[model samples]
Target: MKKFNSTIYMSGKYLFVGMLLLALLGSCGNNADKTNDTGKQKREQLPAQAGKEKAKTIVFFGNSLTAGYGVDPSEAFPALVQEKIDSLHLPYKVVNAGLSGETTAGGKSRIDWILRQPVDIFVLELGGNDGLRGIPIAETSRNLQAIISRVREKNPQVKIVLAGMQVPPNMGRTYASAFRVVFQQLAANNQIDLIPFLLENVGGISHLNQADGIHPNPQGHKIVAENVWRVIQGLL
Candidate 1:
């Protein structure tokens, strides 16, 4: 009877030990599954966080040419610039802050409003109207300088590109010549990029202009976009 009792005790103890081991294994497995699940959740969320990144902005501040006066807004040079940036998958947003008949003085006044938002790259395209109106070169120069100073004050890190413009020869050789020199001097003094002549290939070309023979047609705007892209591409 003692031998039989000892055997039964041994059997019971072994059974209990086996059950405990099984329970421990199952708990470990559950913990491992939970860890894997947490890892997978984090991996899935990474792309969502990356997609939230905001694109930098490029503000095109100018007059009728930048506004696409005769053409559709989509046909404007600034819009076309946006298309180019999108095509390359570049992280940039273009804002066309153009107003028709905007002169250097007007730009100086309106710049404060435009600067309320962030500006990564600022393309200045004013002074053309000033030239057309035969505004004094000194006044135009002062206004442009003031606009540039305000832009820098708002954001010292801002990259500026000044669009050079030319008035009709009828404006007078001395006046037209002085007007053309203003852009060069500003670019040099301000140490910013210049597009030499904004309407390079399209300016004097009759077919490239609209009925007003001042603002560019759609095709002309395309060429103008190319001209701008050439200079700004390097900056980007």
Candidate 2:
């Protein structure tokens, strides 16, 4: 029998085995990390994408009136709107981004953050604070304009609703009159939806207001909800 060349055969076998293992290791390296990263990306993106599809939001962005300062939040007009939506089996989400004492300028400054997400219907309920603070009428109008412009710029398809608000005559007939007109001008200028007066039948009614004569009582919010619902019903 011929003696086998053990060194050559053994070296060839070992080299083949080594190369196969090297290929496998190179292929498998970081596969788990890659899977985790891809999965993480999917997890991160899924909720926002889902929210866009699943949420039909109405944002009532304003101040104390929107906040329900004198009553439970659920008793607020925005919350009442939500109740109506839910009762009617409407697919809508209400975001009450109402900050107490928020002025038109404040709303303007912070509105970019408010609009970071989807807004189907944007209800502008600001400027009352601007009026109360005796801020210049032109400045109030300009700030409100900027806020509305930003909302339109952010979501062109967003249906805007301007909620008309009035300041007391104590500010003098001229200032008070001009303040009321600001909202009318904005609603016409933007051609957006209008809630003629957020506090219609609720504003001056002593029984409807809290002691502050500013924030509404639960009864007051009910009237407000009606005002809003009447105007926005067609949109829904």
- Alpha-carbon RMSD, each predicted model: 2.2, 8.6
Candidate 1 C-alpha error for residue 119, in Å: 1.8
Q: Which ten residues in a row have the lowest lDDT in candidate 1?
A: 48-57
Q: What is the lDDT of candidate 1?
A: 0.94
Indicate the TM-score of model 1: 0.88
**Candidate 2 to truth, TM:** 0.77
Off by over 4 Å in 2: 1-53
> Please, what are the lDDT tens digits per residue for candidate 2 over residues 1-236?
12367877888899999999998887787787798899999999998886564559999999988988978999999999999998987779999999999998889989999999899999999989888888999999899899999999998899999999899999999999999998999899989987878899988888999998877899889999999999998998
- TM, every model: 0.88, 0.77
In the range 43-105, model 1's lDDT, one tens digit per residue, is 999999887768999999999999989899999999999999999878899999999989888
